[model samples]
Structures are given as C-alpha cells and as structure tokens.
Target: MEKIATIGLDIAKSVFQVHGVDAAGEVVVRKRLSRARVIPFFAKLPRCLVGIEACSNSHHWARELIALGHDVRLMPAQYAKPYVKRGKNDAADAEAICEAVSALWLKKTRKVPLQPRKFLDFCWYQVNFLENNISISGG
Candidate 1:
C-alpha cells in the first residue's frame, strides 16, 4: 500500500468515510469508520494533512485532529462538489474533497495588501464585549 500523504474525510451522523492518497496522487486508502472508531483509526497513522467538509460539527473534529498533531482544514462542501466524479455518495464526496485539497496545496499563493478596518473592528468587539458581560457592582 502506498504511504498516505493526505486524507479527505466525509463526516456524517454515524458513519464517517475517509479517502487517502499518496504523494504521487494515487489512492491509498478508502474506508468507512463509525463515530466511535474515527479517533482510534487516525491515531495510529503518521501525521498528515486532513481535509474535511465544513458542517455543523466540523470545527470540533478539526480541533481533535489538530490535538493529535494532524494538520486539518475545513473546506466548504460546495467547493469540493465540482471535483466529484461519477455520482454523489460518501466515497465520491471524499474523493472530491481530496482532489480539491490537492489543488489548493499545489497552487502558488501571492501576498496581497490588506485593507485597514481598525475602527470598524474595534467597535464590533467593544459592542460584543459589553453585550456579553453583566455589570455586577459599578461604583
């Protein structure tokens, strides 16, 4: 079996599907894991980049994987859809995510000048802080 360099994970309510690929872009692994088995399965593998479709609990999974030393990215489902091959299924979705992730890593990035919005951001933070905090004793 080829050494897995990257993995695309398709998360669902109970069953989670994973599609892995080697550095040469060949499929290395394709398996279904239960919710209970996801962590143990990934724990045994060497550190690698993992791509996940952004959904309700994706952030939680990303955090867990990161804690295990895996670099994880949350990609929007719509972004991965165009790369899907034949049909729509968990496996297909995983494959699509892998393809999309591969493309993202292979592309060159350029530094762009960021627009300044200091005042706007400061006001937003101030408003949120005030709203979330309760004034107990004010002198």
Candidate 2:
C-alpha cells in the first residue's frame, strides 16, 4: 500500500494534541499545543492530510487548516471512538485520529459544514452578556 503522511488533531478550548505519521506509517510527530499556537504550528508543517474530530469548533479549525494548503478531513467523534485503545487521553485520541485517517475508513465518516467563527463567537458573547445582565438584576 502506498504510504501517505497524516496528522490527527485533538482540539479543545485552549490546548490541542497532535499526532503525525509519515508515509511508512511511522510516527513522525506527537505533541500538545495551545489554541493560540495550533495554527502557527500547522502553518510551519509541510502540506499533508489533517484529521480532526467534528465537534463544536471543528469547522473553524478545518477551514483555517484547509486554507493553509493541507487536505483536511473532519471525522465524526463516533467514528473515531473505536480507534481509541486503552486509555482516553489526548495522546491516545490523537493517535486514534491518525489511525482513522491512514486506514481510510473515514470516507464514510460524516462531514460537518464549516461555520463562520466570528458569528459563533458573537453568539457566545451575547449569551454571556445576557447572563451577566440577568445576574446583576438578581433575576
């Protein structure tokens, strides 16, 4: 089988875990990064396949990474769950992402449409603001 470089990103609010494998299926890079540094990190990597779990903020990251010239694939978390071996941790999750991508079982995985980050951010901010106002009024 032809080998292809792949990266799996386990994203969160502030930190993210990344797992990478080369064409030969050899682990290339595995590390954790903060949200602030994730883009810059990928920006420095050579273009390759990137896999991320389809979740709350995934579309935003997917769009950003795709724009960086990498082939990005978003796999629903359910599809990735089985790949988890023993423990449930960032490293393990990252590895699962890598395995799921390289194995190509992801073709059937559902893909979520990308949403505008700014719009989501605005919605979240508005909710928070309303909550604060309600609290101030003892409601």
Candidate 3:
C-alpha cells in the first residue's frame, strides 16, 4: 500500500469522508468513517497533513488531530468549494478539500498559518470577549 502523505477529511454530524494521497500523488486511501472511529483510524497512520474546511467545529477537530501528531489546516469552505470536480457529496467534498489544500501549501501567500491552533484559539477568545462586551453594554 502506498504510504499516505496528505489527507482531506470532510466531517459532518456523524459521518466523515476521507481522501488520502501518497507522495507521488496516487490515491492511497478513500473511506468513510463514523465519528467514533475517526480518532482510531488516524491514530494508526503515520503523521501526515490533514485538511478540513473551516467551520464552527473544525477548530476542535484540528486540535484533536494535531494531538495525534498530524499537521492539520483549516481552509475556508469557499476556497475548497472551487476545487470540487464531481457531484456534490461527502466524497467529492473530501477530494476537493484535498486538492485545495495541496494547492494552498504550494502557494506562499496563505492567510491562515499552518498549525493554526494558537491563532484559532486567539480568534475564538476575541470573539467571545466582544460578544460579552456587547451584551454588557446593551443590558
């Protein structure tokens, strides 16, 4: 089996689609994983880059995957959208994310940093702080 070097994970409420490519750009893994099985599945693979579309819960997932030793990037959903090449579905979304991420890494003007846990956390904190201040001022 080809060793996976990068992966795109499309996560929904319960099911997740995964598309992986080897160093030569050959498909090495394509599967669906239940929410409960995601951690276990990735835990067994060697550390690799994982791409996820940025959403409300993507940060949490990124942190978890990072803990497992994988480099995770959260790309804007719109950025990945243009990469979809087939019918809309979890599988296609995953593939699109994979392609988008690969392209993102190649370019030098990335808006989001790699291993963005700290940046994300700081942003989250800022949002919360602003929300709290708004409520206090309004009440």
Candidate 1 residues lying further than 4 Å off, grouped into runs, are: 105-139
User: Local error of candidate 3 at 139, Å?
Assistant: 38
Listed in order, each prediction's TM-score against the native is 0.76, 0.75, 0.76
Better lDDT candidate (1, 3): 3
lDDT of 2 by residue, 1-139 (tens): 2233899999888889998988888888888999889989888887898889888988888889888888888887887788999799999999998888767546765444455577989889889989888444556
Q: Judged by lDDT against the true structure, how good is candidate 1?
A: 0.82
TM-score: the better of candidates 1 and 2: 1
The regions of model 2 sitting more than 4 angstroms off are 1-4, 110-139
Q: Give the per-residue lDDT digits (tens) of candidate 1, residues 1-139.
A: 5678989999999999999999989999999999999999899889988888888988788877877778777777877888999888999999988888778563432211122257779778878878999444666
Supply candidate 1's per-residue lDDT for 92.
Answer: 97
What local lDDT does model 3 show for residue 122? 82
The C-alpha local distance difference test score for the whole of candidate 2 amounts to 0.83
Candidate models: Cα lDDT each: 0.82, 0.83, 0.85
Backbone clash numbers for all candidates listed:
0, 0, 0
Q: What is the lDDT of residue 97 in candidate 2?
A: 88
**Rank by TM-score, descending?**
3, 1, 2
